[model samples]
Target: MSNISKKNKGYFSEEIVKNYYINNGFKFIEQNFTVKGGELDLIFSKVGSLKFIEVKNIDGINDLFDYITKKKLNFLIKTINIYLYKFDITNIDYSLDVVFVKKNEIYEIYDNIGI
Candidate 1:
């Protein structure tokens, strides 16, 4: 796909993921959070824990292995930290998660992969 097509697809996938999360009882915090060269697709709270969610429009977990680069993970981690600091949010557990959407199905991985 072209760059523009890919970006629009990505944004649409994120919106789908966000809605799925919300329907499943997650509190939506923000979407398309950007800071400098870093960005996080979704930030949410669930069962007293804060979730930094990365949505991937992939078939499965294995498909994510090649997609989440180390550099991108570093950027995401730094951005989440900055967001926490900027908002003065503390005293709650946090985790990195991925919501993989394929067709009409949704699969979630909670702190399963390091990135």
Candidate 2:
């Protein structure tokens, strides 16, 4: 596939994951949140917990560790902190999550990621 096509596919995959989260009872708070060199794909709330989500269209999430390097993690952490500080949100527990979209299946990993 061409680069443009792949980019489009990735965007569609993220949209699908966003809808899935919404359908599954997560309140959509934000998307494609960026500050400086960092980007968090989605921010949401579920069961009273704040979620900082990263959406990926890859086949496996185990490889995510390789892709989201330390520098990127630092950036994302800084961004999330800035967001919380800017919004004065200190009551909710927050976690980093990953939504993986495959061909016909979606997988979610939560709370353990440092990103």
How many backbone clashes does every candidate have? 0, 0
Per-residue C-alpha lDDT of model 2 across residues 1-115, encoded as one tens digit per residue: 4455766877787788778879989999998887777787888898878888776777555765676678877887888898898888987888887667777467555444884
lDDT per prediction? 0.78, 0.77
Alpha-carbon TM-score of each model against the true structure: 0.80, 0.79
lDDT of 1 by residue, 1-115 (tens): 3444667777878888888779989999999889998888999998888889888776445755576788878888898898899999898788887667665357655463453
Stretches off by above 4 angstroms in model 2 are 2-4, 59-62, 107-111
- On TM-score, the candidate that comes out on top is 1
In terms of lDDT, the poorest run of 10 residues in model 1 is: 106-115
Query: Which ten residues in a row are the worst by lDDT in model 2?
Result: 103-112
RMSD, every candidate, angstroms: 3.0, 2.6
